[model samples]
Target: MRFFCIALAAASCAFADGVGIAFPQENALLPAVKRTYVIGAIPAADATQPLTIAGVTNDVYKTGAFIAMVPVEGGTNTITLTWGTNTLDRTFRVAFPSPPKPAATNTPPRDVRKDLGIPPDEEVSDARPKGKRIEDLTVMIDPGHGGQDTGALMPHGAGEKTVNLLQAQAIEAEFAKYGIKTVMTRTTDDEFPALYARPRRAYAEKVDAFISVHHNSTAADRDPREVRHTAAYASTPNGLALAKAIQQYVGPQVTGVKNAGAQMRSYAVCRNPAVASCLLEIDFINLPEGEDAALNDADRRSRIAHAVLIGFLDWLFAPDDGT
Candidate 1:
């Protein structure tokens, strides 16, 4: 059968006959694997026959959705899809897994400190409040997703919910070093707190700050490799200040990832008017590199938690403009 070639970068190309591929966007770089699934749809009006990819037949639903597993090699691979009399081709690259490099020390770049106006010799105690005792300060920590609400999942089965809890616990441990008390929404993976309840808990505790820890994920249509970064979001003035502090301190700790900067977003867990709240999107966990550095690396996770603690401390010590 003659096949019409679609550009590698195109997520879907509509033809006169109404056949399209919906996922594994064009020129996408995927983890090195022997097989991968291709998902797409044919117009229901034209779905007269079963769809096949790489010679494997896939059952098309009544709505025309079809998914089929196809074999791929270490380099560029092509997938051929056939339905009825139409044929289409999609090409993507499967990146070979790189050899593990020697672990590097998790040190924040000197420029990061300088940019934040912190001297190299400064200690956390130096930023302590003047009249207020550190022991009296309290903060609320909300790990983003839990239980069945697994925020994002990698191909190998690691869930973002587990990573969020781990990072939150690490941050809590760091905060403890300064005598700061932290209240977590839920300490275990089995507990799933409602989104609205997270901010309510922060307000009820009268905490000095609220931080919701989370990892990011790219949309199915986007290239995961192009969207790895650190971001923070806030809804109110106080939240903005807290988010900016996080962006300044935690941004550089992720090493190669770019800091996408603090943005204004009214996320459910960060909109508490009574408490300074910020949601930290540590990195895009959908990317393999991001998954390894942000989720799997224990030392890197601890360093990120320490950076977050430092950022919160800095925010607490800044002069209040009475917002």
Candidate 2:
């Protein structure tokens, strides 16, 4: 009897190998906005037993698979899957959504011109560098997403990868005119490197600055045309300065693009400690106008490229900081 029990236990272990929880990964941070589906593959040996998950009985199919819609409340929720004596479980957090801000008022905004302490007729000084040159600087340009990763695909069939490569190429061309050396993470549409690998190239090349180009997307319910903004992101303080420079120049150069300002974000490419880095969201690709400006129009692409080059030059030669 003891020898027979040992053989049965070994068989159970082999069957357990086929059982797995595929979705709502172990110790995952799940969004609390809506109920999520818990999907998994069940072993045929455990198919006869009732599968209890978080007090709910889940129905398993003959094909040894199961899918259940689980309501996730805010805070930690322990999910337990049990089939007879064999059990599998995982703990995950359902984060609380941030509170919505108050709606904007209809009143006209107050003018802050009085706070400038300058006469309205006085001429503003030129912000561009006069004699500074970046001939010795080497910049690394990253065109975000490519190949299998077609990021932010619009319903109209526009892909962000195409625009990213186009913009990166144009930027490279403009930088060459200033005698500044430039390198790209990807020069073609079919090449896609891992996220960390993109910034690692900058360190390997010993470049002074890194910029990743990308386009923006909106929620499914919102109309893309209603929201068109140009934004820049950086992780470090020096990177923030570069982001600000890009925002200041590229925002206006893109014609219809609204200046969303520079934001500090800890993105993978922007977190490289060895080089100053920023990610530029040139335009919203989902919208018709943005699609025309960012991808379809050659003149707009050239203008944006020139604007980015000018922004980098401004950052490199800013009188107040040590670049």
Candidate 3:
């Protein structure tokens, strides 16, 4: 039996022959909840034998991808996967969240803003040459997670992958109104483009900007009802600017959710150095309200799509700090 342990987010492990777990990295600290998902793949050569996790036989797609929601409890949880003669074991820790302390009634409201040392903006001059027109610019839209990788599955609604594609299509349609050209990484449900390849396609197509759409999911221990927000992420300064712009426009348009703000994270899709790239977590799909809006509310999705386009335009036209 091969054993591995990891704790960082988005970590994955594979054996020498390419069979391995792709998510929930080994030695992860999870919420004290009843169940969590395990995503992995096995070699096509071993297709004749069944792939079992914790003794439960899972149906592996032709692409070898498989995802299973498995039972987990508080304390140390060990997950074992068996494919033919190969056995892999991953360990995780589940802990309940500590209760929040009561707030003091006498305490005053706090100012949330802090100094980010951003330079003052310069006024645009009519003499300055006009930049490229919106119609001349091109954007690449990537719908995250597809095929056997279902992303975060909602209890009462469509999976994250499905909603991601839907929102991407809506965004594409909204962009069309402005004559802005848009290229999609995948337009169908069955397409599962490689994570790294998504950005490469953007670079090859010479897109001015890249946006990856996705829904967020919390650990099992957290109450989905209490969590509702939209977040954006990027790895570079330019990417951060784009992310912040998206957060500004997309957050408020989603009626019930709060703006969680932009963050710096090195996601694979957001690492495109050729152009500004951002990954948008439009909403927490695990929540019923969030899922409902994403899966059922057509107007809400269109509003979000328009907001995102506006955010992109705002960022593109903003005066540069000359960093």
- Measured by lDDT, the strongest candidate is 3
lDDT of 2 by residue, 1-323 (tens): 00011223555644343355644556667765456555555575566679887679977755455655667788877677777665666676777887877998898753222232334565432122235456767889999999999886532344689899999999999999889899999988899988888776776676888999999876433445566788999987888888898778887656567889898997888876667889999887654455556666888888888889888877877877634
Off by over 4 Å in 3: 1-130, 321-323
* Positional deviation of residue 315's Cα in model 3 after best superposition, in angstroms: 0.7
Candidate 2 lowest-lDDT run of ten: 1-10
For each predicted model, how many residue pairs clash, with residues at least 3 apart or on different chains? 1, 0, 1
* RMSD after CA superposition, every candidate: 16.2, 15.3, 12.9
TM for every model, in the order presented, reads 0.61, 0.59, 0.62
Top-TM-score candidate index = 3
Ranking by TM-score: 3, 1, 2
The 10 consecutive residues of candidate 1 with the worst lDDT sum are 122-131
Per-residue alpha-carbon lDDT of model 3 for 1-323, expressed as tens digits? 23643423222334534346644666778765778766655665555568798889977655455656788888888899877556678788888656876976888642111111112352211111127788888889999999888897553324699999999999999999989999999999888998877876776676788999999887655555466688899977778888887788887645458888898997878766566789999887654356567877899989999899998888877786211
Task: State each model's CA lDDT, in order.
Answer: 0.71, 0.72, 0.73
lDDT of 3 at 102: 92
